[model samples]
Target chain A: MKKFSAVLLVLAFSAAALFADGLSLADQGVFSAGGIVIQNDGVFDPVNGQYSTYGQLLHADHANIFYQIPENSNGHSMVLLHGYGQSRMGWMGTPDGRDGWNDYFLRKGYSTYLVDQPRRGEAGQTSVASAISTEPQELAWFTQFRMGRWPLFNMNSQFPQDEESIDQFFRQMTPDTGNIDFDVIKDAMIEVFDKSGPGILVTHSQGGFPGWTTAAASDNVEAVIAIEPGGVPFPEDKLPEPVDAGYYSVGGIPMSDEDFDALIEKPIIIIYGDYIPEDSDLPAERFWRAGLEMAYEFEDLVNSMGGDCTVIYLPDIGIRGNSHFMFQEKNNMEIADVIYSWLDDRELC
Target chain B: MKKFSAVLLVLAFSAAALFADGLSLADQGVFSAGGIVIQNDGVFDPVNGQYSTYGQLLHADHANIFYQIPENSNGHSMVLLHGYGQSRMGWMGTPDGRDGWNDYFLRKGYSTYLVDQPRRGEAGQTSVASAISTEPQELAWFTQFRMGRWPLFNMNSQFPQDEESIDQFFRQMTPDTGNIDFDVIKDAMIEVFDKSGPGILVTHSQGGFPGWTTAAASDNVEAVIAIEPGGVPFPEDKLPEPVDAGYYSVGGIPMSDEDFDALIEKPIIIIYGDYIPEDSDLPAERFWRAGLEMAYEFEDLVNSMGGDCTVIYLPDIGIRGNSHFMFQEKNNMEIADVIYSWLDDRELC
Candidate 1:
């Protein structure tokens, strides 16, 4: 098992110059939030024989809508993606009944669109085996996200200790019914990308898995903010299964020169937080650190291919004591401010 | 999203009196290791419409052993189950190339048995789905384990900082092939328990899933230390598939009143660390926190059934700065000291 070649965790330096963000200062009429139909196509359920629609067609995935359509609406619209076993609700409210990122972003002035993956949350239905599973017994938020050591080892954790908050967070989660079809997710998201017009995409966790490829699949995508992404394109001719989700291409997937050209200027920022172990004893920590290495390698890959991608490690920048779910942390607003500033510096605002 | 009833993260208290432990300090000759064949059975291969042995029957789950005869051993033995994407190597060596728990436990005088699950590591072939998948991108360790915040927010962490150490940790990881076949894991582990005689079943991460059920399946198991368990019984008639991984019975599954009595005297301790969040903004953190709630409920269930299951939160006891892989951490020896004392308290060591 001691076989792989030695690797390093290097943060690449971006040489691109900053630009003024084109955020509209003028007051506008509509401030709205809604779900975009990522994949509405259907499959030939052999049981049903004839091809049906994705929802009626394949019996998978659903959505919602609400907004002030901000009178001060900036032309910039952002897409919000929840992690595995979750829906759009996560971006709207915290488990502790606090203001979630969705509202923050809305107030931040970006028109936000949230998504529920096929067969989960508002997404109607899908197969059971391929859906997301939090079935793992030992690894969860307490351990995986680094909120704390877990099982209430120390009640002094920064996580909201109130019972009501915990309950609220727990109640909003939704499980997957079948295997995760990354291709389907990409297709759906790309569709949303086209329907919603080119804007910035913000993805978290499992959503980050598809986020990379979806960014590459569409010309409409201006940039991507992958929050704690699960998989980045593994700098390979053929991107990995879950990353490509059986798709022919996505960001980082080796392709014809034309595809690579399309990826140019599609600014991508892979956001990470503190707690990625340098040499912790836990396999979970080690495994996570391994994933981050892939992302770093990806930054190198995308840059080598002439794509614009930057890696933002919050800890490196001075913000500390965050779990994986930093966006919803008590200090999430502060973290968001950091991200917002970066976007402003890059003129993505 | 805030549509749920209030809940709590409760740490159950036990009123049992303390007792002296009976240990054997005799010097034994010839320290050795071997694997226990948990399953040597045949199966019907539906694809071939014929009967075939499970990975050649004799090649079920594998385990290591010590002491010419496990039964003749000095009143102490241990069976170890590694977390997701990990094998027995986790117990023998840290990813950073340090002395791991395997050697420590061996030095502590307990005959240790290490297991590589069916189709995982050295256990040979099994279902493709149940194999390990490194697809999870951001949430596993950095935030989930609690070393610190994620996305490069902070670099100051307690993880080993040497490059060689970091390289060693990344090299040993194995990826999953198909969906995790939890039932297969449970069967293999239970068989090991019966074949090796009752001893302490120590589990980490995903292995904790089968760990709980294996304990329930075999009355031979003297005690269990489920470290930062991901899912406990959910207080349901039949445990959820991902939770129980589709086994007929386990915690959360109802049983005959007589069968419940079999759980008596099963001293179980669920250990956790300090990083689990109190008000994380990420759904990954909340989802994980929810899993802890289930474990808490399971403790309540086991206790009401007369089982001695105590949740040991490390931070609460003044042990902090630990990650999910406490067994392999730099201060693992300290954590082990705590587990060792607990085992001694129960006379299981």
Candidate 2:
């Protein structure tokens, strides 16, 4: 008991420290990268267009809102989520210093807030860097792969000479490499919601898992737009055990038919890449068919418990490129447009 | 024109000689690898309850006609296409080597044929090895990251030095760099189809694209089970000009949409990994999104055009460690079950 309590205290301290060092929405460069003018309310620099840092975004006394108040009001707000290893910067249209989703949302007369969730994006980067510095050998696989070294067996060969070597190579790439603290993230989201009120939550990839978990945990969330969300239970009879200890658990994380029932009551839109296979060379037919089945199951489960849910499938919107990150693609605007239209039509915000 | 004709003749002669000298399917160990058993055939030795060579499965003429059995009283026929740089051995299953899709299908009373497509699998290895005795520097980049090497710049920091560098790294991963001849593949498929009649074409990753292309070009392809078919057109607006001289090309190819329409009226089932994002953290979101969107578009378009198509999304799957390649995972049986069930339900013989 004492050990558990001590661990909790350390976790709490780390959480507080993370908030203190967090990057603001602007300092995180989400808006500036999208060419948006930050309107500051004296706390952070709004004159030079620099908004709050990551810490400020997490612990701001007031809402650090960065949006365009259109002359003709659409009375709508657009929220965007980034995938794994990404921050709110993912919603900001282009990472290559071009117009991003934020500018598009603003231009469409909708309020946009590219929220930087704790333990992700700039914060996550800090954590990863710290981890790498502290555990060089632990991160050697990732580093080696990034540096173009042969970290695993050659996949380009017809028959790899060493199979066990390849298996060991991939055992590494997990998120629990002694870097991120999930408690900090949960608290940050709680704080942000307490201050900002509920709005639409649009997430991509792993971001969708947290978004779903948080939404399920809170009633404040209005709607969810999941672009390749990654957290729901798999269709297989047996589920994979949870790897991460936080909200994104693969284990039976207590999400009941009741939780899905409540979730479906809220409007949820899913957009996934259709070209990916469930298994290698195995077409995604079963998995996707299972997803649709799951959607129906979710809807039925929710409706049975007095909740209304709607699921939409956007086929072939082109999210896969060389690297597999959807936000970095050239047609992010199309994705943004589809999402924006969905939010507007639903009026969830 | 005369010089071109002479070159073509010389190439044809060389290709014939090479094909003659090349390793037979038996020499390449297909029977043992694919778990195929030929009854009443004296060409192969069945030792210790395992077929020793593909000679039993091969016709007297060394053609793949054994797979073209006109009628099976108690079984059906299934064809498997491996991913890039893989061969029939891939279908022989993974680390344990106890479960390949071919065996599963065969055990289910479906005769299975593992195809060695042009420019991929064993064919590619032989071609590439013959073409360049020493591994090409280009090939180094393909396997470097997998081999625990950083295929990019050496930046010690966790965050990319800048977004530009991240974008550059992702860009390097996109170019097409394989020596497989698509024309040769198409011809081979045509030859096989001519003898085999209509059958289900199962493809993974890069194999999906060519599978779809082949299905769209041939009338004998009854259905396509595309496992994570990569390279579908994304963001309808950004489609590239088809380079090959084919009916699907925008400018060069003789095969047009009309030809595809005539050939492909069959069902297409796409199976994809649900948790994996198609892009990495880079400035290619639009490109990736385009790919995703295009995959969806392909589904809808094909269906709208009288071809039945479906996309299946599998959960808890990633690029490595129980993801990416299908034949490697322990759940390959479940994957096979899904494909077989889909085929059975559709009544596609």
Which candidate number has the best lDDT?
Answer: 1
The residue-by-residue lDDT of candidate 2 on A49-76, one tens digit each, is 1222311111111111122233333555
The DockQ-derived docking category for candidate 1 is incorrect
User: What overall lDDT goes with each candidate model?
Assistant: 0.52, 0.39
Q: Please report, as a residue range, the 10-residue window in candidate 1 chain B with the lowest summed lDDT.
A: B5-14
True-vs-predicted CA distance for residue A285, candidate 2, Å: 59
Q: Over the stretch B32-145, how does candidate 2's per-residue lDDT look in tens digits?
A: 011111223233222211222222221010111112111122234566766654343455333232345654554454545666553222222111212211111221221111
Question: What digit string (tens of lDDT, one per residue) describes model 1 on residues B25-45?
Answer: 122111111112222233322
For candidate 1 chain A, the 10 contiguous residues with the lowest summed lDDT are A5-14
Per-candidate DockQ vs. reference: 0.01, 0.01
Each candidate structure's count of clashing pairs: 109, 109
